[model samples]
Target: MTSEVTIRSIQAADTYPLRHAVLWPQESIDYVKLNQDEQGHHYGAFCNGKLVSVISLFIDGNVARFRKFATRPDCQGQGIGSQLLRRVLEEAREKGAQRIWCDARAVNENFYRAFGLEPEGNRFYRGTIPYVRMAKSL
Candidate 1:
């Protein structure tokens, strides 16, 4: 079923809770906080007035990198994350980003591929989980 979701720019701190809950529940909350968060554009998807998904965009020169993208387990498969990502990509392009990329978890490679991001370089592991660098031109 589809839900009424709103995607909006939010402060970096606002993403911590959701990011920790969905992306790194087994690790300390601090583990989900990125050092470069303050230099990025943060967006959250609110469904039924509750924050259900979030993504962060960091731009350096013409390249925009998004990290810490996550959706609450119960909210996964509802398209909230996809909507937030599309909005972020559009905003990045509007801001003159020539390329957008992320180190996507191996399992999520197909998801990013759906949005035109292709795997680049060899796969690496963050802890024991595998990841691949993915990118696409804006």
Candidate 2:
């Protein structure tokens, strides 16, 4: 947190550790991995050269979806997540995505809203966690 955050494309496997650590500490690290990870574009936010946040973006036609976005718990309020998300959004647009979306944790809906993503559809559950679809036109 002492250094500036840098965002860069990373291999999908590079996102696994932080994804497991921040999003589901109780689950196995494999639980945080997506079957289609190799086909997606992954981005990491590094602070002082230490990876602190990760997000995976997938593009299909003109639609882009981002998943497994997790910021290190200790780095949560430092604006690192914001920087990473903004980069992902710009990446999507650069890649010809007309829209972008995510299955956002219901409790963190406000965070997505700040980036112009609006909640859509009803709330749903993944195990015991509540989630909602959020999207925005790029």
Candidate 3:
């Protein structure tokens, strides 16, 4: 998969498009909320220097909570999510995080489980859809 993919932190200028392309497609993503409370770390995956996926990690104490993880629809099946997740998890471990956790979209539990995460509790709703709380010890 030497497709010249690079993973790095999000740039401020990419706030809007990255949100639209990844976080919320039909409804507009609220960049203002982030501007007012920028409390997380965001990572962007690039293919040939063009962004193809985005993942955000919200750190709270010793845990890292991943959020808004999305890969370009066209690139979804090609392992971009897996790669980005691997890097993000590694980064968390390096940063002294004792645990890495996330609200995995209901349908994506198997994918997260493949990386050794275990469901910690019952599914919870985010807006309307449900998500599972998955966690792994770093």
* lDDT (tens digit, per residue) of candidate 2 on 1-138: 568899999999999999998899999998998999989999999998999999999999999999999999889998999999999999999999999999999999999999999999999999999999999999
Worst 10 residues of 2 by lDDT: 1-10
State residue 32's C-alpha deviation in candidate 3, in Å. 9.5
Q: Of the pair 1 and 3, which is ahead by TM-score?
A: 1
> Would you list the C-alpha lDDT of every candidate in the order shown?
0.93, 0.96, 0.80
Against the hidden reference, what TM-scores do the models get? 0.97, 0.97, 0.85
* Model 1 worst lDDT run, 10 consecutive residues: 1-10
What is the per-residue lDDT of model 1 for residues 4-110, given as tens digits with 9 covering 90 to 100?
Answer: 99999999999999989877789998999889998899999999899999999999989999999999999998788899999999999998999999999999999
Model 3, position 36, has a per-residue lDDT of: 23
Best by lDDT: 2
CA RMSD for every model? 0.8, 0.9, 2.3
Residue 86 displacement (Å), model 2: 0.3
Per-residue alpha-carbon lDDT of model 3 for 1-138, expressed as tens digits? 668788899854454576576656766666323542377777888998889888777777788878777788877888887899999999888877899998788888999999999999899996777889999999
Q: Candidate 1 at residue 36, lDDT? A: 96
Error of 3 at 128 (Å): 3.8
